[model samples]
Target chain A: MVVGFAIVAAWELVTAAGVIGFRRPIYNALALVGNMLGLAVLFLMLNAQFLFAAQVIVYAGAVMVLFVFIIALMNPESDVTLGPARGSEWMYGIVFGLIFAALLGVLLVNQGLTGRSGPFTPEVINAVGNVQSVGTALYTTFLFPVEVTSVLLLIAAVGAVYLAMRRIR
Target chain B: MPVPAYTFLLLSGALFTMGAIGFLVRRNPLVVFMCIELMLNAVNLAFAAISRYLNSLDGVVFAFLVITVAAAEVVVGIAIIVQVYRAGRQMDVDGLDLMKE
Candidate 1:
């Protein structure tokens, strides 16, 4: 758990300090991949076995690899970095973000007082939540969601095909 | 001596927060996507804990569904990014002003 938290902290630090500028798309993509892997490992530690695998197979394996491919596809001559904002505009944006963060924090803390608060921690998560148990639950109680997800995946597949076709044309 | 549930909760919470911060602060689209994944993983941890406590796998099922959705989301996002890169000659979110920038 401590290690997981440390990784998360490092990710936060790396990106926030401008260590991951958009100038290097491929490197940024790779870093993102590492971050996703770390997250999935942390998920497994939390006992969400099925989710962790899906996170690895679907996200880290499939999605991230595709993202890297996109980076490869980009024309090398193109520059991706956005120029720094001038004057008060930068300050204004940061101020608003801070305000929003503060508001969200207040709302969450208040909600905790209502007794509807639940755990969102790592220790609470673990490997007991594996594929076998998840499937049993899905087939039994949450069959409705499973069906809905199938429909969603179908739509996404069709959409991808359509988009790819347009590109080919 | 014994592991407390709060330890997990706090760990996941801190990680999720870091992810959120990374996603927002970074201009890189890839980093942003990774941060979103981090946040999703955090939720998975929450599901896991509840499942363990109840000895019911409902939470795990939900987490799996979320992961599948995330998979679909990534596919679509990458396809879009590919197209964007091909046309704009730039992957920077700021510079790729579709019509003109």
Candidate 2:
């Protein structure tokens, strides 16, 4: 398990860096696809079978396809130049990243996982099935949020159509 | 023994930091959006890890919801980006400052 985790972790980091470091938008999109796939594998390792599926289908499959399609359609130019005024922006970005990482490290080291354990242990989940338990919880405990999310999705769909239609008209 | 939860959290934090840096440093708006997705994925990783460690399904469900929201956001955002591109606007986030005036 340790070796597997290490391999996946390395893959995740490399692909993530690719997503950010690639000059071309298409390459960035492709790198994100790889990163999402690595994340899906991690979800599986964490015993989140449903999340693994969702991450694969939704993120790697649907979302990345959209990104690649848009990149193809727009054919955006690679960011070759830093521009005259914005050249130093990356230095600030690096500094901010260092500080943010340091804070997270301190928090993780100081205060570890302190949350109360719940009822769904691995044995229980295995008996009930991972997807079944998650679905029941979603409908029972999280029904309201699920309904709201559906409404939000509907609104987003309508908004997207409206935005696209305006250009046609 | 199984992998520790803190390791997962650490990886998530690193990925989030990278995404934040990319969001700030990248000039292209599309890349910025990609960085946002990276950050969201990192959060999802933490959620799943914590959920497993805590023996709860809440984090998994929450991660699922986040995936849904991200999909919706991407659809709308990409549509807007396409519109902007069609309008002949520059693709750089720094250059698109029409609202400032």
Candidate 3:
């Protein structure tokens, strides 16, 4: 388990760097695809089987396809157009990044996970099936949020269509 | 032995920081969008890890909701981006300051 986690973690970091460091938008999209896949593997490792599937199918499969399609359609130029207007931008980024990392480390080390444990342990989830339990929670305890999310999705779809149609006309 | 949960949280933090840096340093709007996705993914990872460690399904469900919201956001955002591109606006985020005036 340790070795597997290490390998996946390395893959995740490398691909994440690729997503940010790559000059071309297409390459960045592709790198994000890889990072999402690695995250799916981590979800599986955490026993979130449903999340694994959703991450793989929705994130890696559908969303990334949209990103890649947009990149292809727009075919935006590479990072060459970015003149040295903000030369010190990266230095600020690094400093802010270090501060954020330090804050996260302190939070994790200090507070840790203090929440009361719930009923669904790994063995229980395995017995009841990961997807079934998650679905039950979704339809029961989380029903309101789920409904709201569905409505949000509908609104987003309509908005996107409207935007596209406006461009057409 | 199983991996410690803190490790996952740490990785998520690192990824989030990288995404923030990318968002700040990258010039292209598409790359900025990708960096946003990276940050969301990192948050999802932290959620899953915390959910597992706490023996609860809430984190997983939240993560799922996040995924849904992210998809919707991407759809709308990409549509707007495409519209902007079609309008012959500057593709760089730094250059697209039409609202500032």
Candidate 4:
């Protein structure tokens, strides 16, 4: 568990500090892939086996590949760096982040893992299986949203093709 | 024993803050997108932690939806970026103001 947290912390540090990504966006993209893999392990630790597999297959495999491909295609030799943030804008951002963190800490301390048991207990999942339970719930209770997601994906594909296509008279 | 839920929550908060800082500091549009992904992953961690703590599957399901939506959003966003790059040969977010007179 601590190892997982350590991985996230180190990865966040590398990306946040722009250490590896000062000149190359590909490094940051790869770091994101590593972070995604770590999150998959965390999903497994949480007993979200199906989510773990999905995170690996979808996020680590597909999404990161897409990101790396884009970064490479955009400008392989060009150095990509952002201008340093000017003035007190960053100070404000830091203050806001600290306030948000404090709020989360307070909420977590007061709640402290209080949760009601649902249908997908460990034994229930063992009996009906994780994939089946998720699929059942997705198709039955969340059917509309599932269909909407499919539509969203289709629209995204069409929109991407249209946007990236060369203009033709 | 597994890690405490509060630990996961705190970690989520920290990751989200880091992502926010990255988003603020980065000028490269691609890096900004990556920061957004980091924020999304942080939220996913929180959802999984809550689901595990509550013995409920709802949080996991929502996280799954978040992942799916993120995939779609990335497709559209990167396409727009590619289009802008092809048009201007510039990747800086500040230079993307095509409509400014």
Each candidate's interface RMSD: 5.5, 1.8, 1.8, 3.0
Off by over 4 Å in 4: A1-23, A76-89, A166-169
Candidate 3 clashing pairs, residues 3+ apart or interchain = none
Error of 1 at A127 (Å): 13
**Root-mean-square deviation of candidate 4:** 2.9
Q: Which one wins by DockQ: 1 or 2?
A: 2
TM-score against native, each model: 0.69, 0.96, 0.96, 0.88
lDDT of 2 by residue, B1-101 (tens): 37988899899999999999999888888999999999999999999999999999999999999999999999999998888888888788888876676
Best by lDDT: 3
For model 3, how big is the CA root-mean-square deviation?
1.6
Q: Give the per-residue lDDT digits (tens) of candidate 4, residues B1-94.
A: 4567787777777778878876765667888898898899889989988887777778888999999999999999988888777775557766
TM-score of model 2's chain A:
0.94
Off by over 4 Å in 1: A1-23, A75-80, A86-129, A167-169, B53-56, B95-101
Q: Residue-wise lDDT of candidate 1 within B1-101, one digit each (tens)?
A: 13345544544565466556656555556556656766776666666655555545566677788788887787676666666654554445545566663
lDDT of 1: 0.60
lDDT of 2 by residue, A1-169 (tens): 9999999999999999998899989999999999999999999899889999999999999999999988888889788863554678689888989898888879677656888999999889989898999999999999999999999999999999999989731
- Quote the lDDT for A74 in model 1: 54
Winner by lDDT between candidate 3 and candidate 2: 3
Candidate 3: which stretches are off by over 4 Å? Answer: none
Candidate 3 versus the native: TM-score? 0.96
Higher-ranked by lDDT: 3 or 4: 3
Q: Clash number for model 3?
A: 0
